[model samples]
Target: MNHKEINSFYTYLQSQQTSQRFLYQCYKKIDGIDAEAKSYENCTVFMYYLDHGIKFYNAGKKLDILMQPILFFYGMVHLLKACLLTKRPNYPESTSVLAHGVSARKRKKKDYTFLEDEVKVQHNGLFPYVSQHLFFIHKMPFEKIMMKNLLGLIPDLSHLFHFNNQESMINVSKIGSHTIDFTSRVLDNYHLTERAFLERIKPYLPPIVEVKSNHTMFQIVLTKPILEPSGPFFVDDNQNIFFPTIRENFLVVSEVMVHYLLLYNLSMLSRYEAEWWGDLLITKPDVDYPFIAEFLRISAKKMPLLIGKELLKMK
Candidate 1:
């Protein structure tokens, strides 16, 4: 607003190590997609080039433990959506959002509906009958023979491990919702819901962590240590601000600001990470198994925990 204010803000920015350093890096990459970048042949290689911090500066410290469990379960949720009905990225005659009667079960041939549950089950698992009656029979040789004779009988459960179809990846909603502890879910028999999980890690979180959701939301007061997954350095604020959160980290910070007489600004989000909260799809038409014989090995109970453990190990 005024010359004094402008100078003060600049000086305050210079004071923050993480914010100032990351903001500059983001500006260079603001040019958008790195088209000159090479096409990746594998997810590992692709993920390598897509390294979260590599585009900017490699973050000097380890990222928090909470990030992957949140994202993997989120991505896995997309897989569940795929099972709800037979969906295609584009259709035979025209392309739009429609699920076909590809479901081999005698259940509704064509079902159209959308759901937003913090669930961790396969598409078939969504059905009461499939999860209840078939719970034990699904494991028998009879079910295997049925799959051969019936065709498409087991949509989601039969192919739980297949990761080849890009269209099958989860579709992400652009905007988001706010919740204090949204990750927690209590299945009838299971006990390891996300809310319970966060509680396990609560002792490790510093007072800087205000809320935990899609991103770690931070409450910036005049002088609290604000830890962002973004980049290096954090700035001290002169004023009190509130409700600063991260989509990437599922963390929420509130009561944040800079300056009593001074001024400051903190950028929202670091390098965009779609995998954190988005769905999974198999972009390429043909890569590996078009069929899902391997899916039988996965049970509803074996999921989220199975995959969640692996994702955490990668971090």
Candidate 2:
């Protein structure tokens, strides 16, 4: 999308606060669905349906609400099947990339064949049936990096109810050591200045953020007072050496790397947990279930309402 289109969409989102309310009601109605249906699978379908309906509607046609959700449902089925077949790795690289191999003139024929065979074996071993399905998902129109950025914003949606309660406050101090290690890894991979990354995302950020970074770690604190009444609140810390921005608070803290933008909310963090969660999402082998669940809950509640209002205002 062009800058104007992006700006228009964002403007629509900002203007339609009631859309968020509608989304929350939808989530409340759909809450009892299986986690797979509620979270990743359903979300994939929702996005697909939105994309399809928007495309169709733009082609000089009336809107079809039923078509929108049905398209989403079909898309969700494909993603659900893939998720079930292949145990998705925390990172995409863990899966195979080669679907087919062609002979290369520069390499000896025998050597090329050998390499291809090896790759095929490795692909089969790592991905199996599920991996192939996942490959398709990766190929979907929305780039993985874009999805990551979008997902990073999810925490803000949930901040309404979770930000400052003692029970909900996330501790970051506990994860400091891990965060440091992860930050180092990110530096090794990207090698871009952190300031550039921050500049790219600056328009989306609130003022007065607290950032911490060393050769080995990066952390950001969004002081509670800075949050707007209608949010996009929470702190974020990225401990992964490859992705230094927290995927929860939409903040970037590293100064010298630029492979991917990490954004997340840190409202649930204690100082230590913030540090550790940052590190884990960036480097570790597991998905942060609580983090993912909370984000899904809030985004589902808020985003649709926001989008709906934007749609009404478009005319």
Candidate 3:
């Protein structure tokens, strides 16, 4: 769905009655606990988060690019908190879950580039907490990801990488409801044989029906549509699936997590690294400008869709 539809979807949750019902069902399904009282208590707070998040995104749209990251990052965080409340009735059980849970370098080298910079995941706080509770990702303490790698994880931004003579993904063509097709040379790209490549992707996909191949293309039939693909497989804004051409390691990150990490760094830079942030925006310096600018634009529209989809599943 587009941003407009997703915005409306979030608006539905703004009602106390609707929000409480959703939380009730979600808590029952996810935790199998006493949900009635908890849902009633959390519904107001949930609506507040959705309200603040939508406002932050709205404010970001009217602000200058320099301030957009800060707004969007917190916007995503507040929305995520709402998501967390669905599963964990008593959120912020302690202060540890309140932190951002990720850190970028405090000092920049004279020649530092944003793409080359990194963020390290901390053991506690909202980042890891949501990673575990919302997305079921765990054991991510102290893991370091380069900014460029995180940017490459976004399917909507794949074209930006392609414009710079890089291939972030290989698009998969859908032949029918059950099958998908892609170039045979994808095997060469990953240095995997057809059998080996199939084995590698098996864990990420649904049950396979069969595989067929020709000199130029390979087709794999699946048991169901890839409605919620993951890792190496991603469904883009247009509903097309792609296998990331980036390293397998980078492909494992979900788009939501990728956006969060990138926005966290960008927000930090906007807040603290004032000199470099201003210079980059005003000077139109390097390729970093294009990637960062494109991401901000895309995330402004894309984040709501991502978060909205997650909320829909909870219902």
The most accurate candidate by lDDT is 3
Query: Candidate 3's residue-wise lDDT over 109-145, tens digit each?
Result: 9887999999999889898998898878776633898
Instruction: Give the TM-score ranking, best first.
Output: 3, 2, 1
Off by over 4 Å in 1: 1-179, 186-190, 193-196, 208-226, 229-283, 287-315
| lDDT per residue (tens digit) for residues 39-61 in model 2 | 34333333444444344323312
Q: Per-residue error at 258 for model 1, in Å? A: 33
- For each candidate, the alpha-carbon lDDT, in order, equals 0.23, 0.31, 0.84
How does candidate 2 score on lDDT?
0.31
- List ranges where model 3 is wrong by over 4 Å: 2-5, 30-32, 174-176, 248-250
Residue range with the least summed lDDT across 10 consecutive positions in model 2? 254-263
Segments in model 2 whose C-alpha atoms lie over 4 Å from true places: 1-70, 73-184, 187-189, 223-315
TM-score of candidate 1 versus the correct structure, residues matched by position: 0.16
Clashes of 2: 45
Q: Where's the lowest-lDDT run of ten residues in candidate 3? A: 245-254
Q: Model 2, 286: alpha-carbon shift in Å?
A: 21
Pairs clashing within candidate 3: none
The true-structure Cα RMSD of candidate 1 reads: 23.3
